[model samples]
Target: MPTSSSSPPTDSPTTGGHRFHALRVVIPALIILVWLAGAGIGGPYFGKVSEVSSNDSTAFLPTSAEATTVQNRLPDFLGEDAIPAIVLITSQQKLDSADLADIRTLAQDLAGLPEVAGAVSPPIPSEDGLAVQIFVPLDADSEVDAAVEALRAELAATLPGGLTSYVTGPAGFAGDLVEAFGGIDGLLLLVAVIAVFLILVVVYRSPLLPIIVLVTSTFALCVALLTVWWLAKAGIVLLSGQTQGILFILVIGAATDYALLYVSRYRETLRDHDTRWAATKAAWRGSIAAITASGGTVIAGLLCLLLSDLQSNRSLGPIASIGIVFAMASALTLLPSLLMAFGRSAFWPRRPQPIGDDVDPQVAHLPARGVWARLPRYVARHARPIWIVVTLALLAGTLGLTQLEAKGVPQSDLVLGSSEARDGQAALGQHFPGGSGSPAYVIADEGELQDVTDALLGTEGVASVAVTAADSPSGTAPVTADGVQPIGPPGTPAPDPTVDDGDVLLQATLAYPADSAAAEDVIRQLRSDLGDRAAIGGPTATDLDSNNASIRDRTLIIPIVLLVILVILMLLLRAVVAPVLLIGTVVLSFAATLGISALVFDHVFDLPGADPAVPLFGFVFLVALGIDYNIFLMTRVREEALHHGAREGMNRGLAITGGVITSAGLVLAATFAALAVIPIMFLLQLAFIVAFGVLIDTLLVRSVLVPALGHELGRHLWWPSRRIAAASDPAPAAVRADTADR
Candidate 1:
C-alpha cells in the first residue's frame, strides 16, 4: 500500500517541457472558449422549445394506428380541424324557456371568441331539465390552454347566477395536460438543477469543484437542446412536453455522472503528476473508457425504443440518445479542459497533495479508506454469502410485480393535482351521456354511410349517431334507420353528407365516458364488427391503441435492450460471464423496482393506475443506468486486475470507485426526484422507480452484489483474458492486513 509523503517533489522542467507548457495552456483555453460559444448559442433555446413542440397525443400516435388515420383524414370530411370543448351548465331548479334562451345566447357569445373555430352548437337540454350541454370548437393550432382559460373566465362572468359551469372534453383534457407540463421548461429545470447542485456540493465539499462539474453538465444540456430544438423545428423528429422535460433531466444527470467519474480520476491522478496538463491527460486516459462505455450503453438502450410501435417511444429514442452523446462528449472534452485550466485550486480548501515527482503516475495511486474500504473487506471475507443474500433480497422485491397494474390510467388521472377537466367529467356523467362532446368518429366510404350508421346505432354502448353535413345549419345531421334527419322544421329536406374523395365521417355518441374502460371495450367491439368497413377513432380508441402499442413495445424492446446492453458490456470489459451476471443482476433490480413501485403507487400514493408505457420506460432507464454503475466499477476493476490480480483488483476497485459512483447515483436520483414536482402522473411514477432503482443499484447492487460476486468468481470473471490464471491472486498479506490500505 502506497501512503502519502509530506515532502514534495522538485520541479526540474526541461527547456522543451517549458516551451510546450504555454502550448498546453493555450489548447485548454481554446477548448474552453469554443464550448463557451456553443453554450451561449444554445442557452436561449430553453424557452423556444414550445414553438416546435406539442402536447397533442394524436400527433404522436403510431402512423399505423386507426386513431392516427382518423385524425389525419378528419379535416377532409369535416372541412376544418379543431379540438372540441364541452360546456355543461347545471342549475338546482328546473330551467324554463327563459333559461333555455339565455343558454342559447351564451352559446352564441362563445362562438364569437377568436379561439373558437367553426360554430358553437345550440344548447341541448338533458332529460332532467336541470342541465344543458353545448359544444364549442377551438382552433387546434392555437394556444389551447389560453383559449380554455379565456372560456372559463367568460363562463365565470356571463353564465346565469343559478347555473354552475364546467368545460370537459378532449380539448379540456388537452388544456389540463398543457397546464401540467407548463412547468417543464422553467420550474422542472430549476428544481433538477438545484437538486443536482446540492448533491454535488455535499459530495465534493468544495464550492469551486461542484460549480465546475455543474457547468460541464449545464453546457452539455444547452448544446443538446440547441441541436434537438433545430431538429424538431426542421420536422426531422417530433417533440412532446414529456419528452422535453425528460431531456432536461437526462442531459443534466448523465453529463453530471460522467463529469463525476472524470473528476474522481483527475483528483486521483493529480496526486502523481505535478504538471496540470499531465494530470489531465492521465486522468482522461484513466476514465474515458468507463465514461464512454457507460454513455454508449445508455444510448444503445434508449435507441432500442426505435423498435416501438408508438411514435412517442420512437421519438424518445433519438432525442434521448442525442442527449447522451452530448453528455459523453462534454465530459470527455469540456470537463478535462476545465479541470486542467483550474489546476489544483479547483479543489479549494482541501486540495489534493501531490506525490513525489519521481514516482510513475501510471502505477502510483492513492489508497482508499472509510466505509468504502471496510465494505470491500467484508465482501472479500464472505463473498458467497454477501452475493446470495443480496440476490435473494432483490428477488423478493420482484415478487411485488404481481401487484403492478400497467394496463393504462384514465385520462382524468394523467394530471396529478387539481383538475377542472376531471371535475367536469364527473359533472357531465351525472346528467347527460358520459361521452358527450368526444364522440367516436368513423371514417368509411360514402356509399357505406347508411350501413355504418346502422352498425354504430346497433352497438351496445353507443347512444346515437350523426353524419357530418356540409350544408347543415349546425354542420351535422342526426342519423336514424330512415336516413339523415333534417336539422330544421319537419318540411325541410335532409342536408347532404360531406364527401371527401370517396369517404364520409360518422360520429357515434357513446353511453360511457370516452376515457372509460367500457368505452374502450365499445371501440374494440366496433372495430371487430365493422372490420374493413369503417375505422373507429377518438379519445377511447387513441388510449386503447397507445396502451396496446406500449405493451407490444415493452415485450419486444425490453429483451432487445438487455441483449444490446449485454453486448456493450462484453465489448467494454472483454468478458462474457461478468456481463451476463451484471445483466441478470440489473434485470432483477428492475423487477424489484417495479414490484415496490406497484405497492407504493397503490398503497401509499393511491394512484389510480399507470400508463402501460411506464414499465417500458422504467426498464429502459433502470437497466441502462443500473448497468452504468457496474460499468464504472468493473472497468476500474479490470484495469486494476491487469496488475493486482482479480480478487485484489475487485476489492481495490470497489473501495476507490464506490464513493464517487455513489455520489453520481445520488445526483442522478435527486435530479429524477425533482420530476415529482411536475404534476404529471407518468413523470411522478417514473421519478420514483428510476430514483429508487438508482439508489438500489448504487448503494447495494453495485456496492455489495457485484463486488462480492466478482470476488467469488475471481479470475473466471475476466474470461478469455490472456493472463487468466495469474488474475486470481489476492493482495499481498501486508496490504490485506492493513484493512485501510489500497
Candidate 2:
C-alpha cells in the first residue's frame, strides 16, 4: 500500500502554469464580489414571496382532475371568484328573538367588509335551535388571511352574550394555511442557518470558516429564490408556500454539503502544497466530480416529479431543480473562491501546516487515532459480520413499514399547531352538516342534471342538494325529487338553473366534515357511479384526487428516480458493482428511515396520519441525498484504490473522509430538522424522515456497512473493470520522481 512520504516535489512552472496562477486570485475575487451583490439583491425577496406564491389547495390539483374542472367553472356559476367562510354561532341555550336579531345584524355587518364578495347569508337556525350558521363569501383573490382575521375580530366584538363563534370553511382553511407558512421566510431560514452554522462551528472549530460556508449557501438560496420568484410571476411554474420552504432548505443543505467536501479537499491539499493557489487548484479538481455527480443525482430525482399527476409535485421538480443548480454552481465557484481567499487561516487554531516545511515529523505525520481511524480497522477486521449484522438490522426495521398509514390526513389536521380553522371545523360539524359551507360541486349535462342530483342525494354521506340558479336570491335553488324548488314563498316562481356550455352545476352538502375520510369516500363512490357523465369536485374531491395522484406519483416516479440515480452512479464510479452496492445501501437506509419514522409517528408523536406523498418524498430525498455521502466516500475510495489496492484504498479512504462526511451529514440533517419548526404536518413529517434517513446513511450505512461490504468483496467490487490492476503497475517516470520526492 502507498503511504505518505516525508519529502515533497517542486513544481516546474511553465508559462501556462504561471498564467493560471495569476488567474486564480483574480477569478476568485470576481466570483466573490458577484455573489455578494446577488445576495444583497435577492435577500429582500423572502418577504415578497406571498405576492407570487399561493397556498390554495385547489390550485395544485391536476388540470384533468374533477376538482380542477369544477374549480375553473366555479366563478362562472357564482359570478365572482370567492371562497366560502362558514361562521358557526353556538349557545348552550336556545336563542330567543333578540339573539336571532343580533345574529342578523352581525351578518349584515360582515357584508360591509371590503373583502366580502356578496351578501352574507342570514342566520339559519339548526334543527335543535341552539346553533345558527351564516355563510360569508370572501373574494378569493383578496388577502384571505387578513379578511378572515377581520371577520374573527368583528364576530368577537359584536357576538351576543354566551354565544361562541368560529370562522371555518375553504377561506378559513386558507387563512390557517397562510398562518402556518408565515414563518417560512423568517423562522425557517433563521433556524436552518443557525443549525448549519452551529454544526459547522463544531466541525471546523473555526469562526470565519463557518461564516464563509454559510455565506455560500445563503447566496445560493437567495439567487435560486429570485429566479423562482420571477418564474412564478410569469406563470411558468406554480410556486406554493410548501415548495418555497423546501427550496430554501434544499439549497442551504446541498450547498453546505458540497462546501464541506471542497473544504476537506482544500485542507488536505494545503498540508501538501505551500501556495494557496496550488492548493485551491488541487482541491477543486478532487472535489468537482463528486460534488457535480451528487448535485446532478438530486436534480434528476427532483425533475422526475414533472411526470407526477399533481401540479404541486410537478411544479416542485423545476423549482427545486433550479435550487440544486444554484447550489452546485455556488459550491463549485463561490465556495471555492472563498476558501482559497481565506487559505489555511480558514482552519484557525487547527490550521493545517504544510508537511516537511519547517514542521516536526511527529506532528506532521501523526497517524489518525480517533474514532475515524478505529472505525476502518473494525470494518477491515470484521467485514462479513459487520455487514451481515447491519443488513439484518436494516431489514428488521423494514417490518415497521407496514405500520405506516400514508393515505392522507384530514385538512383540519394539516397544520400541527393550534388553528382557529381546525377548531371552527370541529364546531361546524357539531352544529350543522359538516360540509355546510363547502359543498361537493358537480357539473353534468343539463339534460341529466336531475338524474345526477338524484344520484348525489341518494349517496349515503349527502346532506342536501342544490343547483346553481341565475335568478335565485341565494345563487342556488334547492333540488328535490320533483325539480328545482322555489327560492321564497310558495307562490314565487322557481329560479331557472344556470347553464353554461349545456352543463348545469349541482352542489351537494356532505353529512360529514368536508375534509373527512367519510366525505372522501363519498366522493370516490360518486365518481365511480357517475363516471365521466358528471364531473364531481369540491374540497372533499380535491383531497381525494390529490391523494390518488400522490399514490400514482409514488408508484411511477420512485422507480424512475432509482433508475436515473443508478445510471449516474455507474457513470461516476466507472464500475457497475460499486454503484449498485452504494445504491443498495442507500435504499436500505431509506427503508429503515421510513420504518423507524412509522413507529415514531404512530407510537411516539401519535400524529393523526400522513399525506400519501410523505413516503414518496422521503424515499426520493433519502435515496438521492443519502447516496450523496456514499458518493463522497466511494469516489475517494475509487481514486485511492487506483493507486493502492482495493483493500488498502478502502481503509485509507474511510479514515481520511470520515470526519468531513459525518459533518456534512450532520449539516444536511440539521437543515432538514429545521423544517419541524414550520408547524405544517407534511413538512414536519418530511423533516423527520429525511433528517433521520440522512443520519442513518451517514452514521451506519456509509460509515460501517458499505466499507465493510466493499472490503468483503475485495477487488471484484469493481467488476468488469481491470482498473484494480493499476494499483500493482509501476508508476510512470514523472509520477515516480514525484513519489520519490513526496
Per-prediction count of colliding residue pairs?
0, 0
Candidate 2, residue 211: Cα displacement in angstroms equals 0.9
Model 2 lDDT tens row, 1-742: 0022354433322246767867766898999999988888898999899999988998899989878988899888878788899898999999999999989898899899888997677788998888999989998888789889999999999887899998989999999989899999999999999999999999889989999999999999999998998999999999998999899999999999999999988887877676677777888898999998899999999999999999999999999999999999999999888887877777888987667535654234224588986777667777788999999999999999999999999999988879988898887788789899889999999999889988888889999999998678778889988889997877998899999989999999999999999998899899999998899889999999899999999999999999999999888888899889888888888888899999999999899889999998888888989988998998888887887767767877888889999999999999999999999999999999999999999999999999888878888888867887545533333333433453
- RMSD in Å for model 2: 4.6
Q: Give the TM-score of candidate 2.
A: 0.94
> Cα lDDT of model 1 overall?
0.88
Candidate 1, residues 1-742, lDDT tens digits: the string is 1233454522222247665867887887898898899999999998888789988888878899999999898988776589999999999999999999999999999999999998888898999998999999999888888889888999999998888999889889999999899998889989998899888888889999989998999999999999999999999889998998888899999999999999999888777666676678789998888988899999999999999999899999999999999999999999998888778889988787676546665445524457875788878877788899999999999888999999998899999879999999998988888898899999989999999899988889999999999888778999998889998877999999999889889999999999999999999999999999999888899999999998999899999999999998888888889999999989888989999999999999999889999999999999999999999999988887887788878877888888999999999999989889999999999999999999999999999999888878778888877654463575434334554452
- Say which candidate scores most in TM-score: 1
Which regions of candidate 2 fall more than 4 Å away from where they truly are? 1-22, 357-367, 726-742
